[model samples]
Target: MNERATLITNEIVEAIRGVLRKNNVTFGEYRAGFMHLVKTQQAGEIPLLTDVFFNSTIVDIENESRKGTRADLQGPYFVPDAPVITDGQIAVEDEHKDKPVMVLRGKVTDLEGNPVAGAEIDIWHSTPDGRYSGIEKHGNMDKKFYRGRVMTSEDGSYEARSITPVPYQIPNKGPTGHLLENIMGGHSWRPAHVHYWVKAPGLRDVINQAYFEGDEWIGNDSCNGGLDEMVIPEVIENGERIMEVDFKLEPAVAKSLQAAE
Candidate 1:
């Protein structure tokens, strides 16, 4: 019987036990906590463990040189092939009229600082009220709202008009919420930010999130894992918040064609 699997399982269990022992937790206490977690799951409550596991799966692309722009979490709400538009306006609904308007202009360039024309940038973000479109709360099934795609011009310049993003809490109503508020004593809020998925030929793809500068949760982003480089400068012009940022992409590595000798 799969002795290797059994050995690994035992090792993992022992590791957990080691941490529990270090924390002065007894088996009874652990068992009681597990039972509470089970009850919470049975009641359709999302546990903090789920979010921990989910966030762990999100990979952060680090910029070792700290040049250009670094990548951030792509998040779980991205929809491929969103409607392409030239205006780059995503927040156009009447309900969003009262929200602060934002103008985002940027240039896509290679490492050498040359503009990369025709690059596609897919952008999406949470609404001003902190609800993302296509989610259960928003109930957007067929149409895509607050999400769109824009292409770079002949000079690799692009602009988008969207509402200013607002800081919002993660799903904090279930076991996850309880753990953040009680057991861990941490908050489950993310800083105001907008997501971007940029793609260009012969260059590596970039998925990033640009954060607002003065967000209250900037120092306490729960999901971004404390990447300060994601924050961008903000300015006000003509009663609109304007953010100007540039992107630099690295050359893509070609697939190896040699056969194993």
Candidate 2:
């Protein structure tokens, strides 16, 4: 086996064994947990389940050594290469007309706060009812509601428009949801948020999710994804909820994308 894999695997195994010993876990309970894993795999929700439990921890570790905006989970519903949106209206369908309009404005910058021009911001988010455009069960594959791509301008600024997504339970009818509620005693509700995958040449891309201020699950998201720095206060005007949150990227291939900020 690979030395690093063996070392890490040994620690993980020992830690799990220690938990079992500490709890005096019975074989029956262990079997049940195994079966739960089987069902989660069968449901094709292993990533979803793991994200709910551990993706945040992984992201925290990644952010610890970086000087850029914190990264968040890239949830299961992302559809790539969405059409380039120009009018700033990401929420396309008429169904979104009555919801709380969310105007997202931001800048893509480097650690030194210099602009990253021509950066592609691939963004996807749920409707006000929490259904993503391409998710089959949620439906709307025929329409690209609340999903699009935007590019940073010469000033390294980008903007998008969508509705404020409400807190919605993940696919909780499955084993993952059941385990969370019955075993962990927690609701499976994510907060109102928007996802932005910021990409530019020579820089490490940032997977960002912007959360609304005063969301019911601000600090208590089921996925535990968004960090305090990612939250934006809401400013309502003429029935639209406007939010501004900038994203800073870390250098990957070099220290500078451009000399100008």
Candidate 3:
């Protein structure tokens, strides 16, 4: 028997039933809701809807016993195989010369505080104008900008330069976007953040987004996935916006040991 599936499915069914009952939802309303879900699925927006509404809870539950950095959803904008950055610059193209520059420096370490050299950190984020490069839907340009991979040096330190992120609205041109904006009575703005994905051999890879401190949408993320530990301040000293944040990875051996236990 598929015990876990059965248990989860039953629980979900019960939860939906409770909502229906509590709201005294009529058959017409229920049918309309069902059709909306169908439209969302047909429009390939189920993932967006799920991420906007529920992925944060899943991340939180899975991270309850984790000892390293917290994990987060990769979102829908991730593009793999970004070019490696050697000049410490994340923004390419000449147009970004006028954009505000942001410097991100960090160290990747193990749970025991030992530095993990040569860890590959992949990063991508939306532009200050609320567009992500290489995403056609974000901007007409499909060139890679503000996206690259950097490796932690011998001391596990890494740095990259890019433009600061600004709050971006979820693309509301599709069915899912319409549902979130029109029917959900919710805003589609996400706080400014930088997306990070780090990996090292024999260590579990972690993907997380770091939000800027004092963003008005911090507590009201459209996805509800923001964490206090994942927030960083806008460090402006000498007229430069440089910030520092570190990540730690627990050894894979530890996860295996825990499973055995």
Which predicted model would earn the best lDDT?
3
TM-score of 2: 0.92
Count of residue pairs whose backbone atoms collide, per candidate: 1, 0, 0
lDDT of 1 by residue, 113-194 (tens): 9999999899888888777777664667433677888899999999988888788887777776777777789878888888
**For candidate 2, lDDT tens digit of each residue in 119-156?**
99988877767788877788656446778889889999
- Model 3 TM: 0.92
As for candidate 3, its clashing pairs are none
Q: Report the error of model 3 at residue 232, Å.
A: 0.9
Residue 19's lDDT within candidate 1 is: 89
TM-score of each: 0.82, 0.92, 0.92
lDDT for model 1? 0.76
C-alpha positional error of residue 134 in candidate 3 after TM-score superposition, expressed in Å = 2.3
Which window of 10 residues has the lowest lDDT sum in candidate 1? 252-261
